[model samples]
Target: MASTKKTTAAKVQAPIDNRETFVSLQKSFADSDMPVEEKLKTLYQLQAADSEIDKIIQLRGELPAEVAALEEEIADLKERSAAISAVIDQLNRNIADAKLAIAEHESIIEKYQRQLETISNSREYDSLNKEIENQELLRQIGEKTINDTRMEISSKKSELEDLKDRLSIRTEDLAAKKTELENIVEETAKEEAVLRERREECAAKIDARTMSAYERIRASVHNRLAVVGIYNGDSCGGCFNTITPQRRVEIVSNKKLIICEHCGRIIINPDFAQ
Candidate 1:
């Protein structure tokens, strides 16, 4: 009597509204009658697609980080520039106050001198002279303070100019870098999206158990290679380990999954790799 068992073709529905559910896709592949070789081939395709995505990500290396750093630096520069401007303003105010003090001292000296001319007593005359001397000293001190403040303002202005020049150059650099990063991201975004869709499609066709195994191996491996082909008809493609005649024949037959003993990578015939 012939076997009554029936094999059902694998049916994987595309994502609804462009939204994919990994659980549903996994269950679909798990319940399907997809052949083991077909599953391995699908895994290989997925790996290739994912590897391309990896390359795309690598191409964008450090650009985002650089953009962030430039932004932070520009912000810090602007803050420092503002602080310097504030200092300059305060120095100018101080200079103005010093000038006012000098004027007040000069008026006091003039008043004391006029009082000295009117004093008849020697004691009163001496007191007026001392008052005039004190006022003159205060005027000299105020003048010195104004001069120091002006020199400081001049120095601050020079520093502010240097900062402005530096800030301008950095701003220009940041703009160029931002544009460059945006262009690269824009170009790769479409390509990556297509590759991702292809990967998901391939994943949906693979058996759940096989997909789980492949993912496990991929995660464990440093280079993310879980599926590899025969190399030179006698060696494993992943680790370059020599394969025995029997094992090589089994791998070529593709009747079942074959793992490399040395590297634990899933081995496929070289023909299937194409």
Candidate 2:
């Protein structure tokens, strides 16, 4: 009997048509009516604008306190100056009163001198002389009081002048700063508009799900990158995390969408050199 040879067929696993799947998904994404990427880009533009607005608001918020503090300081100085002015006014009144006293004393002195001519006896002459002596003493006191008030007025005026100068300088500085901030806000407006336009274009290209994922991850990630290419044996280009062999094989196959487990980014493996 001839020896019978048993032939066993090798089992062949069905090949997953990943390229076709990728191509189909690509076409579907490209043909979709909704400009997903543009929407996403618009969202980004809005977010950036909001961020800038927040910064401006924060700066503006801080400015009020600084301005208020400066204003308060100036107000206090004004109050002090007013008080000084009141004191000066009081001193002036005192000086005027002293001058009036001096004038009255001079009048009394003149009357006493005139009465000396009309005195009937030695007793009356002596009495008139004593009255003249009292008036002269009072006049000397009034003159001294006026001199002291004049000195006080001069000192107060000098101090008030310095405070006014300082207040004027401070007001000018605060005004300049406020103008600068306003100018900066105006300048940023055009830049913000351009950024918004660019972001809208970006949104039109990306799909809704992908865009959402990108935005969510972008928020969580410090680098603000949601998509990344794989390089150097399944290493993440964004964070440089070495991917597992299974994940690398899956990414290379491009069968379905795959994300980097570590960084949560869509991974794209470059074609190996043929």
Which pairs of residues collide in candidate 1?
none
Top candidate by TM-score: 1
- Cα lDDT for residue 252, candidate 2: 68
Q: Give one digit per residue, the lDDT tens place, for model 2 in 11-106.
A: 211121245644553455446565534332343454454445445555566666777787888888889889988999999999989999999999
Q: In lDDT terms, how accurate is model 2?
A: 0.66
Q: Could you give candidate 1's per-residue lDDT for residues 1-274 as a string of tens digits?
A: 0111433113212111122343343345446688756766776788889888877886677677788998998899899999999999999999889898899999988888888788899998988888888889999999899889899999999999998998999999899998998898999999999999999999888776667767876666556677788888799876677999999998787566677766666777678656
Query: Against the true structure, what is each candidate's TM-score?
Result: 0.73, 0.53
